[model samples]
Target chain A: EAGVTQSPRYAVLQEGQAVSFWCDPISGHDTLYWYQQPRDQGPQLLVYFRDEAVIDNSQLPSDRFSAVRPKGTNSTLKIQSAKQGDTATYLCASSFLGTKDTQYFGPGTRLLVL
Target chain B: QQQVRQSPQSLTVWEGETAILNCSYENSAFDYFPWYQQFPGEGPALLISILSVSDKKEDGRFTIFFNKREKKLSLHIADSQPGDSATYFCAAMTNSAGNKLTFGIGTRVLVRP
Candidate 1:
């Protein structure tokens, strides 16, 4: 089976610009997650969705970050008015439901904000 | 606060030798632990995992030794190969958090041939 896939392997933008990252989870996976991975740090959860419903987004910067999975298969994470701190790799992962489910990750979109 | 922590940000070992990576977590509710491996330009791939109920889990040359009381775990790669060089991340998840993972900074391993 195909693993999760992400678009725009890299992005460079200036401050206050907007950019959107897309993700296509593996087929049949029900849970999709968006994570921000800063340099030299582990991935941090930004938001997640089960099917088309969001499970949690408490960590997402609401003022600038937004994500949606309309069809429950593909997801898009967008950043508005990006800042220097937003310069990090945006990773997308998917998994099934259950306590023992293992997540598979995508290649990730590396963003560099000036 | 960082819930998961890993030691020895970087390590170097000779090929055919055993490389051990250590990790610890502060949360008691985390029952699932997984180790992920990533190359320089690739996303992380699950290497091995163990549930809190088990003290040890083995898969080929990789083994995970878990200590529930101390909330610590170690990943041992036996007969290490040069291709095994990569960044290894230790992660923890709890059922209450919708199985969201909290990961460590990661340990970079270099297996010299």
Candidate 2:
């Protein structure tokens, strides 16, 4: 089976500009997650969905960042206004269930904000 | 404060040697510990994991030794290869509260011939 898929493998934008990342999780996986990984840092959870409902988004910057999984399949994470610190690899992942020991990740979208 | 911490921001080892990576967490509530591996231009993949109830778990050349009381855990890579060189991450999860996985700053491993 194909693993999770993401779009725009790399993106470079000026500060204050906007960018949106798209993710398609593995087939039949009920959970989807979004994470941001700065260079040399671990991936941090941004938001996630259990089916089409948001489960947790506390770590997400509510002011400028937003994510949604409306169809219980595809998801989109958007940064309304980018900043230099926003530069990171945006990752998408999925799992079969909440208690699953493993999560499959996408190739990730590398964002370089200047 | 960072919830999870990992040591040796980067590591280098000879091929066929065992590489040990360390991780510790402050929150006692974290019961699930996992390690992730990522290569350049690729997403992180689940490498191995151990639960609070177990002291160790092994798969192939990888093994995870966990200590609940010390709030520490480690990953051991046996018979390492150049292909094993990648960024490794340690994470903890308690989904009921946040469905989030707190992660340590990754450790980049470089295996030499």
Candidate 3:
């Protein structure tokens, strides 16, 4: 079976620029999540959605970060006015509904803000 | 304050030895615990997980030991090999809180030949 997929394996941008990451979850999966992992640190939840509706995003920096899952299958995470601190690997994962079972992950998008 | 804490920022083990990674969480509401393994430049992959009802879960060379009262857990890798060298993260979640995983800082392990 195909696992989750992500686009733009890497992106480098200058401070104050904008960058976006795209994620396509596994087939039939209803839940998608976005996580940010800094060097040598664990991944932190940026946002998550269930069937096109945001389940939680309290951890996301609303002023700079925005995520959307329009049709409940694919998701996009955008960072505006990126700062050096925003440099990290953006990971996408998905799991089936009702069953918070194991999440299938994709090859994350590595971002570097100069 | 960080909700999840992982011990031993890094560790090194000889090949065929055992590697232990520890983790603890402050959120009592967390009912699901899982361990994730990540290789260089790759996303975290599900390693193994245990629900609140069970105390131990074993999958091949990996095992999870959980203590509900202590809100602590550990991952034990037996016969550690060079391929097992990576960063491991302990995470927790709850049905009521959604699927957002609260992860530990991560433990980097290196297995030598």
Top-scoring candidate (DockQ): 1
Residues B1-113, candidate 2: write the lDDT tens digits: 99999987999999999999999999888988889998998998888888899999999999999988899999999999999999999999874655578889988999999
Candidate 2: which pairs clash?
Answer: none
B1-113 per-residue lDDT for model 1 (tens digits) = 98999988999999999999999999999999999999987889999999999999999999999999999999999999999999999999998887689999999999999
What is the DockQ ranking, best to worst?
1, 3, 2
Task: Pick out the ten consecutive residues of candidate 1 chain A with the lowest summed lDDT.
Answer: A95-104
lDDT of 2: 0.91
- The TM-score between candidate 2 and the true structure equals 0.96
Would you list the rank order by lDDT, best first? 1, 3, 2
- Fnat for each model: 0.77, 0.85, 0.79
Local distance difference test, candidate 3: 0.92
> Model 1: clashing residue pairs?
none
- Provide the TM-score for each candidate, comma-separated: 0.99, 0.96, 0.96
The models' CA-based lDDT, in order, is: 0.95, 0.91, 0.92
**Candidate 1 Cα deviation (angstroms), residue A94:** 0.5
The per-model DockQ list reads: 0.83, 0.73, 0.77
Off by over 4 Å in 3: none
Candidates ranked, most accurate by TM-score first: 1, 3, 2
Q: State the lDDT of candidate 1 residue by residue for A1-114, as single tens digits.
A: 999999999999999999999999999999999999999889999999999999999999999999999999999999989999999999999999885698999999999999
